[model samples]
Target chain A: MCTTCGCGDGDTRIEGQGAEGWHRHADGTLHHHAQPGAHAHGATDPRRLRIEQDLLAANDAHAARNRARFAHDGIFALNLVSSPGSGKTTLLCRTIQALRGLLPVSVIEGDQQTRRDAERIRAAGAGALQVNTGKGCHLDAHMVSHAIAQLDPAPGSLLLIENVGNLVCPAAFDLGEAHKVVVLSITEGEDKPLKYPDMFAAADVMVLNKIDLAPHLSFDEAACIGYARRVNPQIRVLRTSATTGAGIDAWVDWLAAGARAAARSATQRAGPRGVVA
Target chain B: MHELSLAQSVIEIIENAAARDAFARVRKVWLEVGLLSCVEPDAMRASFEAVSRDTRAEGAVLELVAVPGRGRCPSCGTLSALAAREDACPSCGGYGLRPVAGTGLRVRELEVE
Candidate 1:
């Protein structure tokens, strides 16, 4: 019955499909109370109940479980979010290639169709899996959980979940990611952060992608970053051009630090092995 | 855009609560929706009506309570009312405004029989 949170079992239906309900008696006797709705004979009258429950509780619960799994394995999971044509794939390929000798990397590509992104990731010397969400707009925690199980990413490795290229819906679903990195391209204009404030605010890091084109375009880097900061004061900004290989080293360096921290956390959970101070 | 899916999840919550709490029908619902959340009330109501058909929450009077967003200025450490995501700090006129509330979507209460 998944008797955990309110959002249990399935989407549309209740857990118990048997037309009978369990009954309890005062004399310590148990019996089956037949009928689904007509339990009004035993039911109470109309009343208001305070149920402070999140609408996405089911998804959150799944995300919590996934978070626990990642923590156990010392995995630094990242959910890369952005609009279409934000150079997310190119940035991923660049990072994957750069991270080759440092750590083992696994990619979970989310899209409405095709395995092209997954292929690109695999070509960059990393294990990759493609999850086609069909008509689903965002990648929820349940879907990511399944992907992680299938990928079985190595302990203390990096799991980059490239979400479906949509700013709105992806912000509403948490996939148990350690960080949500939003990539915005120079061609997308500085007003993007203002236009899609929810996405910008939800992200922990904002990657200003395709920065090599800044000279040719009128994109205001300072203004763009300022707008992002307005919504998210703690968001860190990184400038990178996935094609020109500029700033990729800095991005990888930051990612390596995060991965190292994750590994240390895992080791600490297993009790400290003394060697150096 | 995801309102339809959100409505579907709401139905699931109602159905699960009904089964667990032994309630047959839900008469009313007080839904707490954050102002900063990118959800349209008209869209949510219309979608809820469609998804709640024949379910426990069918024909339920779904009311939305607008929860105001709050943002804090990083420079001056002043908190201000954030009506939307793009709202700047009223006190400092600074860019770094961190959100503290009004981003949650929850079902606050339900009238059941």
Candidate 2:
């Protein structure tokens, strides 16, 4: 159970899935073989199960399902991750406003408490759902799947999942997103990338948020980008300011491209077998 | 920390394996922790103790196998041991070393009855 969200206690509820929903094992155990003589091993002797399985195989399986569902629905899902107070919500709000009428945009806001971010997103003219992960530092695939099942963003739309504001754990938990976008504010030190290299390495894009404050703050932008590239050479960096709307267009364009690609892929998958529609 | 959740996952895996293998209880668990796997053995042990309560894995001895991180230098094509992801290649002194192994966490073997 996550100490932050009280999640494993079966209290966190997703919309449309009443309380006690979302992967609650009554016994907190999954029993695959009930009978003692089910396997070939002797019933009296001890047996060694050479289970060479990854610790996160369960989570990864859920993520695969989520990814397939997203692909089939033609929805471009982006998992936004960053440290607390890195301006993730503000940027999300700005993004919602920018792409509201042109393209349907929805948000899944994650936090330890409060519907404040969801309300802010709704005020920005986009569909929003709040998932409070009480004591959980990161959002897992199961939680995201439940949230998506309830939210049901329209096909060919963009779903922005703002992960719990943490740099470490979120990197390990895949939420079935098309890409993981990491936000780094200029207010934060440039050494942030080096300090939290896992997040930087896991992310597909690194958004340098609050760039308007770059002049006022002595943040080494080059060093920050350098550090990020050292960890992830393929990561794309976008400079943006939610307050001044400096790089909103580029961000929106990137999102649009992803949504378009998703739509195209979905169409191809839905087409006749072996036919490239 | 997320180690709690990870420990819970380990227990779940063990429980499922026990059921499939028809084991009464788990006597021991052998885990492979890679150098770049981002898991601390001490934290994992503490979390396992906390989450394995009342489960078949309770009181089970956890044997941790440490796997060293290995990377191949893209520049010199030399394979060497790496302690960190950003470690430069030892043979070539190049930063572009691709990790080849020691980045996984897995339940290698289990002793059960």
Tell me how many residue pairs clash in candidate 1: 0
Tens digit per residue, CA lDDT, model 2, A193-259: 8788778878999999999998799999999998887777778999999999999999999999999
CAPRI rating of model 2: acceptable
Off by over 4 Å in 1: A1-46, A272-277
Q: Each prediction's interface RMSD?
A: 14.6, 12.8
> Against the true structure, what is model 1's DockQ?
0.28
Residue B70 lDDT in candidate 2: 81
Estimate, for each residue in B1-113, the C-alpha lDDT of model 1 and write its tens digit.
68888888888878778777888888777787776777776678888888899888887777666666687877899998776767667887786577787777898888888
What are the lDDT scores of the predictions, listed in order? Answer: 0.82, 0.82
Q: Model 1 Cα RMSD, Å?
A: 11.7
Candidate 2 ranges with C-alpha deviation above 4 Å: A1-47, B74-76
lDDT of 2 at A233: 71
Model 1 Cα shift for residue A208 (angstroms):
1.3
